[model samples]
Target: MQLKSLRMLEAVCDTGSFGAAAQLLHTVQSNVTAHVKKLEEETGAQLLERASPVHPTPAGRLLLEHARHMLRTHDLALAQLQGLDPQGASQVAGTLRIGSMETTAALRLPVLLAQLRRQHPGIDLELEAQPTAALLEALMAGRIDCAFVNGAAPHSGLQSWPVFREELVLVSGQPLTRFPTPQEFCASVFLAFRQGCSYRQRVELLMASQGVTAVRIMELGMLDTILGCVAAGMGYALLSRALVEAQQQRFGVHWISLPPGLAEEFAWVDTCFVTGSVAGWSPALRAFAQLLGIHAQAIAAGEHVRPGPAQRVHRRQAEPMPA
Candidate 1:
C-alpha cells in the first residue's frame, strides 16, 4: 500500500471524517475517499467504514498505528540526515511546520514569525492555524512537526509540556459589576462553540458539581460568532483572556472573573497522542520558544496573558485589575 494512502488513512481515523482529513491534507474529499478505497482493496479487508465522515475498521486501526510510526521514523531519519549536513544549515534550512488554534494564529505568531524569519531566514515556515480538535489530529497524524495548542494536556499517548496557567474568564458584552454567582450565571444565556469545546466542557462540569441544572446554552459555529453574539448582548462565554482581548476592539467584548477558583492549564504539544511518536523534535523548538519574548509569546500563542498585580493593563471600562 502506498505510504501516502496510509497517511490519508491515519488522518481519516484521527479526524473521523473523510472530508476533514482531505481538508487537513489540502486535497479534495473525493480523492481521500478514493485513496482509502484503494488501500482497503489492497489490504483485502475493510480499512475504513463508509459513513458520514468515516471511521477505521479493526484492520484500518492497525495499519494506521504502523503508518504513524513509519512517518515519524521517516521524519527523524530525515532530521538526522539534515543534521549531518549541519554545515549548510548551521543556517537552519528546510520547512518548519507550526500548528496552532485560530486565536493563536491571529494573536501570537505575528511577533514570533517576524523574529523567526529574521533569525532563521533560510527556513521556510508554514503556519497551520486550526481548531484544537483538528490540530490534535494533524499532530498525531504526523501532518505537523510541532504545535502550540490550548486545553488540558490530553490524557492520551502524547507528552505535554506545561507552559502556562490560563484562568478561565467569563466574558460578557454587558457590564458585569460583580463576578456572577454560579446560580445567577447558570441562569444567564451561555454562548459557546459546538459540542467538543474545552471551555464549554469546563463550564458544564463546574455547573454540574454545583447542582446547577438546565443551563441556557446556545451553540455558535465559530469563536468569532460566539464573541460577536456576546458583544451584541446575546450571552456570555468562558475563554482565555488573550482570545477575548485579541478581538476586543472589533467584537467589543470584555472579561470578568469566574465565580472564584477556576483555571485551566495548557501547553505546547510536541508529539502526537495516538501515534505515540515525536516526529523529529529537537532542541530547536524550545530554543525558538526562548527566542520569543515570554508574555509576548504567550499572548501570541493564545495562552492566557498573565499580568502581575503591579503590571496589569485593563482594557474594559473599569479600573485596572490583576489579570
Candidate 2:
C-alpha cells in the first residue's frame, strides 16, 4: 500500500535476506521484517518464503514485477512537482552538447540526463557517443564540448581534470581460477580493442611480461560486439567495470579482478578556446558541475566497486599555451 512497504518488499526479494535488505535500505532487520509482515497481512498472502535466499511468494512476485515501474512513476511525479514548485527555479533551457564514451553514455550519463531533464526544462541535450580515442579526437577538433572517455586520452590543446579512475575487470562466463597468473593471460586468446586503445596495450604488456608471447587475439571496435564475444565464451578482454557491470544482467558473465589491476583514468577535458564567456562560466556548465558533484558523491558513498590501478602513473599534461 505504502511506497515504503513496496520498497521493503522489493529489497527483500532482490537481496534474498532480511539483514541484507535492511542494510541496503539503511534500517535494522526488524524494521524490514515488520514492513514485509505488514504488506503480507494487507495483501492476505505470504509475500516471501523464509529460506536461505529469500524467495518471493506468488503475490509478492507480481508486486516485484511492478515495483520498478512504480518506483519510476513515483520519482517522476516528485521531479515534476519539484520543477513546478515556487521554491525551485525553472527558467534553465537551451541545447547542451555532451560528448562521452559509449561506456559512460551507458553507465553514468543516463541518470544525469534524467535529472537534468526534470530540473532544467529548457536544456536540449545531444550526445556524441564514440570510443575513447575518437571522442578525444572529436573533442580536440571542437566537434564536442566535453566528454568522459575510457582509458587516458592525451590532448595537447585541452585542460584535463581527473574525473575518477575505473577498474578494468576481466569478465568471463565462469570464474578464471584456471588462468590465475598473468602468464596464463598471454597463453589464452586475448580479446582486444581497436588500435590506439590504452587498455589493449596494458593487456598486451601484462601478457608479454610473464613469458606470454604471440597471444591469440580478437579485436572488436564496438562495446556490444566485445560483450557479445565474451558472453559467447570467446577470448577474454579488458573493459571498464562501470560498463561491464551495467550490462552484467543482460549478459551472463563472471568477473575476475586482474592482477596488479589494470585501471582506466577519466578526465573532463575542455578545449583552449576560452573566451570572455568561459572566464565567467555559464549555468549549463554549473549544471554540468553539479552533475559531476552528484557523481563524486555517489563514488564516495561506495556505490561502485573501485579496484586499484596496476601501478601509479602520472596523468599526461597538455602543452602550455603560447603567451
Q: Per-residue lDDT for 40 in model 2?
A: 84
- Stretches of candidate 1 exceeding 4 Å from the true structure: 1-89, 155-157, 181-187, 261-279, 282-323
Q: Which residue pairs of candidate 2 clash?
A: 93-122, 94-122
TM-score top scorer = 2
Per-residue lDDT of candidate 2, residues 1-323 (tens digit)? 88998999889888999999999999999999999899888889988999899989887788778876787678655544343322354555445667765666666678878888887776688887665677777767766666666533455355444455566667776667744565556556766666655567656765665567676767877778878888888868776666677788888766766544222332112111211223323455556656665665576477454423321332334222122
Estimate, for each residue in 194-226, the C-alpha lDDT of model 1 and write its tens digit: 665555666687666556766778988677888
The per-model lDDT (C-alpha) reads 0.64, 0.64
lDDT: worst 10-residue window of model 2: 267-276
Model 2, residue 61: distance off in Å is 71
* Candidate 2 Cα outliers beyond 4 Å, as residue runs: 1-90, 150-153, 178-187, 260-282, 304-323
